[model samples]
Target: TDTPVWVKGSGAASDYLALHDRPSITELIATKKAAEVAYKSSSLTAKNIDLAEVHDCFTIAELLATEDLGFADKGDGGNFASQERGLRNNGDVTINSSGGLKSKGHPLGATGTGQVVEIFKQLRGDVEKGRQVDDAEVGLTHNVGGSGATCAVHIFGRSPND
Candidate 1:
């Protein structure tokens, strides 16, 4: 607790259990609702985020997250991710610098905690070289479950005022 990362805001939401019951195939309503609350409570928009550790159990999930979280437009996530712009210090926000769930083996129950740890270290500049987001002051972690039936979004800052 010595190296503190402030929780600026947090939100959670849930939706239909089956993907087919959802209105869209490529988007998660739970994620969007959670993000809206988190962003509003933090008094920050997606542009204010320095980095994000989003649920990427699948490559498409990551892209969907980028859109749902407001990091990119509804359909531009693929483009945003492909341009090297999502890399550390390259664009509006660095994404998945920890290699995300796909690379981190999902970790099932511990996935959200793992994301928080990554953000904690990232804010403190304690991560391995080449993976740290330069000057990371505000970060976000998006966790999902039940095949996008539920989602939790949290924003963290270097300081409460950030």
Candidate 2:
């Protein structure tokens, strides 16, 4: 069974401060901690992972994702982005090659599952259009809503026999 945790960072200033001084920092730390927990709990390892479909809602989100996903350290995600390694197909961790909300149309009602559809296609080699990851066996998705009010993270894989 998968247990999803939703961390919010909105509402009155009191609500915001109660969680943390800065939502971004809280999100960053929480996301990183979540990744550490997930990575350690699962039998799957990062090197064995092939690709990811993260919520690069803003350009900054993309940078944060690299860190959150354990592909890059806290401050290194931006540097990874600068090298074109942050989210390219051949990058260290192929991320949001789907163009994310940046290019992919974000239909509010379907955005979360939409990211899954993209990852499913990518992992199964079912995508032939722009930004398809080559032979991706494992993939991940990160979804969030309204400045971290709601978030979901998922990991997917393609079995050899599938």
Candidate 3:
């Protein structure tokens, strides 16, 4: 399940804060609520997650992502980053270790797949860099556009049949 909200305009820096008042906060709350519902209604378990690739359009986005994905709590993303809890090759839940839009690159048409590609490699342990999680069996991806105007989130893992 997914929830979408509409804002007034282009959501600039000041506009973003005014509109969402800490987008990460909103995302964290949503994430937790979603997880709760998912656990009670489905066979999925959060502990099964092994890694993630998020829309790190900027360093700040990476920070916010961990919380949004339930990897950390509100306001703890920065601390997690500082402590290197989301880096590839390290952290419990690797976030954007692919360099994301911040480092690797961002191709509009291929942006979504690029993010997924990283997740695919990480989950398959085929990554080539300092950001490879060991034996990642599950992965996630967060894609957003225009300062969070639009977002598409997805989860991936090794299927039992695979």
Candidate 4:
């Protein structure tokens, strides 16, 4: 454990169980609520994150997550995706460096753990060269369930003080 990745903050939240009951179709309120708590606890905003692993059960889910997680403007996730702004080595904050849930099939309960492992390796500079994120000092993982009714966010950093 020479290269340690610290868990700077963690947050979880839940909203209405039924999707139809939520206020917005394009946003996951649970994610926003969870992110707010995580950011406050970590004293780090979305702008401080260098990389993020988000739940992408569907193509649109990724887009929504980007917006809900504050990576993009509320309606700009499409542009973000089209511009490859979330792609590794392509943007300010790399999204899904592990190829995400789409590329790496959703393993039921193991998805979030897989994300943490990806960030760990990336922060430690131990991932495959092509897959590694350059100097990733901070990372985030977003997980959601129950059709966006529930969410969990965790932030990590290479330094304890970060």
Best by TM-score: 4
Error of 2 at 94 (Å): 1.0
Q: Give the worst 10-residue stretch by lDDT in candidate 1.
A: 83-92
For all predictions, the C-alpha RMSD in Å is 1.4, 7.1, 8.7, 1.4
lDDT, model 3? 0.58
TM-score, every prediction:
0.95, 0.72, 0.67, 0.95
Model 4: residues >4 Å from true position, as ranges? 86-91
Better of 2 and 3 by TM-score: 2
Where does candidate 1 clash, by residue pair? none
lDDT of 2 at 89: 46
**What lDDT does each candidate get?**
0.91, 0.62, 0.58, 0.91
What residue pairs are clashing in model 2? none
**Candidate 2 lDDT score at position 103:** 81
Model 3 segments more than 4 A misplaced: 1-42, 86-91
Cα misplacement distance, residue 46 of candidate 3 (Å) = 4.4
Cα lDDT tens digits, model 2, 1-162, are 132221111111112333355555535544554455445544454565567777777888888777767777777888877775543446467867777876866667677688878777776667876667776666766766556444556666675321
Q: List the residue pairs that clash in candidate 3.
A: none
| Candidate 2: regions farther than 4 A off | 1-27, 86-91, 160-162
Ranking by lDDT: 1, 4, 2, 3
- Our model 1 lands, by Cα RMSD against the true structure, at 1.4
